[model samples]
Target: MDRKEQPLVSIVIPAYNNENTIIATLESIRNQSYKNIEIIIIDDNSKDKTLQLVTEQQKKDNRIKIYHNSTNLGMIGNWNKCIQMSNGEFVKLVCADDLLDKNEIEKETGVMILNPSVNLVESDTRLIDINGKKTGSFKRYHKSGLVKGKKIARTSIIWNNFFGAPVNNLIRKSVLDKTGYFDEQFTYILDFDMWMKIACTGDVYIIHELLNSFRIRNDSNTGNLIGKDRETYVAEHQRLVDKYAGELQLNRFEYAFSIWFRKFRNAAIGIYLRVFAK
Candidate 1:
């Protein structure tokens, strides 16, 4: 495809200590069916070989550009840097350890072009264990086709729907310019908060096909949080509930009950994992 014929898509990968999985992740992007892509990798001062591996890969593919931080920028900080470095019409963030289907870029970009009103496009996600074996399916907003921004926001918040990880979504550059990127304050619920904000800003399109694999590893951030730092998870979940209470139109009782229910459920899950899972 000529440079002018195909629009550029920027895929930003934020990496820390992911030496073991970084190669496979990069390979997935390099093998994508979409030919016009710019792969930007931001290494957040990884103590391991993550940067070295990415640098070597960058030497081979002109499309892949690697940037290293002199000091650790943390997850949110590095993500913002990735956004700043991207120069594509469509942007996607693929974690260092996750995998994307070869055709994901092609399919998602086509969807975005065909539906001009949609600012965000998300697809069904599948789960893969540490060994890359298929584990299960990830939940997504059920309704497909063009969806209203306010309705998507309200239903996702009120009905307890799970918006899969950022890896499953493709976002427009214009929307990012309007929404102003992910809020850095959110620790666990950053993606969730961003999704809600994006949905409220404009239309969202959902694709029913599975286009990415979210790897489940014990060392991953969410895994570490859920395993030993569950209190942080519970706190962040509560924070989001509190922040969006008015948007969901929750009455006082409904707000209080939702908070209580979330606390109870999270506490129970933590206890169960601590006991029998041991």
Candidate 2:
């Protein structure tokens, strides 16, 4: 399809003190094969050179729209701000430190355009380290196709969030409106919460291809949570399971299983990150 004929996609980036990786993240978006996109970046009062760097990039690309928050709005708050500022048929929340494959947007958009019933489309993710070295890959489904929203939600409740990160997914703005924004009550599992909500609304399309890279840095939020405040991270996961238990009609056995499964999963992930991801 001609770039002009394509629907506009909004790539909303919520950046804090990400001066190191912000430029790379922006470049990844700018290099996408999908030309019809608006790069909306919200700087959440970064204490570093994030704002200045983004401003410099903005001058080169007219499609880049930048906003600076007077005061620091925590991670989730900044994410919501980006969503509010976006005006596109589809929305993608890319973190300041992540990178995308050149054709990521083009392929994901094609899936959404072809499957109107799908409110979300997610692909496999390549995992990279702080130095941008390939560490591993995250591939959930064995095959790529449409999955029932309710089934996905239920599975999440039982087995924990397997939807990967925001970079791995593309969401319809209309569905986000219906599902609402990220829950502020969550710190570590905010994306997981939002994914479950979006999945409850409509079917989710899964693409088996790896279209994005999730960077793992020791100073990153998830990294810090898993390293220093692991107890809190586990608590947040439990909190979400509790919040959705009743709505999903989860039984006592299922609830109990979720709690156990999360602990096991956390342990396994920790081991993987330590042994292979390092």
Candidate 3:
């Protein structure tokens, strides 16, 4: 396809203090098969060399653009900043520590091109360690096809998985416009809330191929925030449930069951991390 014919994809990276892994993140975007993309990085007052590394990469590639915030806006704030800066039809939020396979853009954007109604699409993703080694692997919930918006929300709440992180997904900017920005109240599960909010508006498409890498560090946001704040995590889960209960059409029985089941699951994960995780 000609350059003009292709839709511009905005790959937004919201960085905080990710100096060690920012280069790999930039390289993954630089190697994407789809050419017409603008890489937007918003540095949230990083005390490390995260901005310096991104600035170096920006010099090499014209598609890369870097911005810095005078004050720390936190995670959700930084994400909203990325959205405000992006001018693309499609927006993908990639973590500063994660990696996208070379063909991820080609394939995921293809899904959007073929299915005009799909406002969101996600690919399978694997977990990697700090050294970039594949530490674990598993398949996501949905198969390769289009799923109804309500069904996606139902499955997410019933299973309590929230699909996966935003790194595994490409979202339509129009849908985001309807849903608005990420809510800062959610310390954790912000990505999950955004996914559900988008899914409520239109259909969600899934590509069952593993095309992204999510780094698992002990100090990563999930490990540092969600891991330490189980109570807050549970509260956030309940808040989302209350916010979307009418949209999900969930009854009292279903809501109660889901809350307890998710609590049990969280407890099990905590036990496993304490007993087995290294």
In order, the Cα lDDT scores of the candidates are 0.81, 0.89, 0.85
Which ten-residue region of model 3 has the weakest summed lDDT?
Answer: 269-278
lDDT of 2 by residue, 1-278 (tens): 99889999999999999999999999999999999999999999999999999999999999999999999999888999999999999999999989999999999999999999999999999999988988988885444699987787888779757687999989999987688999999988899999998988888988998889999766677667775577787798889989888878999999989988877777677666665543
Clashes of 3: 0
* Residue 192 in model 2: lDDT: 90
Per-prediction tally of clashes = 0, 0, 0
Q: Order the candidates by TM-score, highest first — what do you get? A: 2, 3, 1
Cα displacement (Å) at residue 240, model 2: 1.0
For each candidate in turn, the TM-score is 0.91, 0.96, 0.95
Question: Which pairs clash inside model 3?
Answer: none
- Choose 2 or 3, whichever is better by TM-score: 2
Model 1 stretches with alpha carbons more than 4 Å out: 1-3, 264-278
Highest lDDT: give the candidate number: 2
TM-score of 3: 0.95
Off by over 4 Å in 3: 271-278
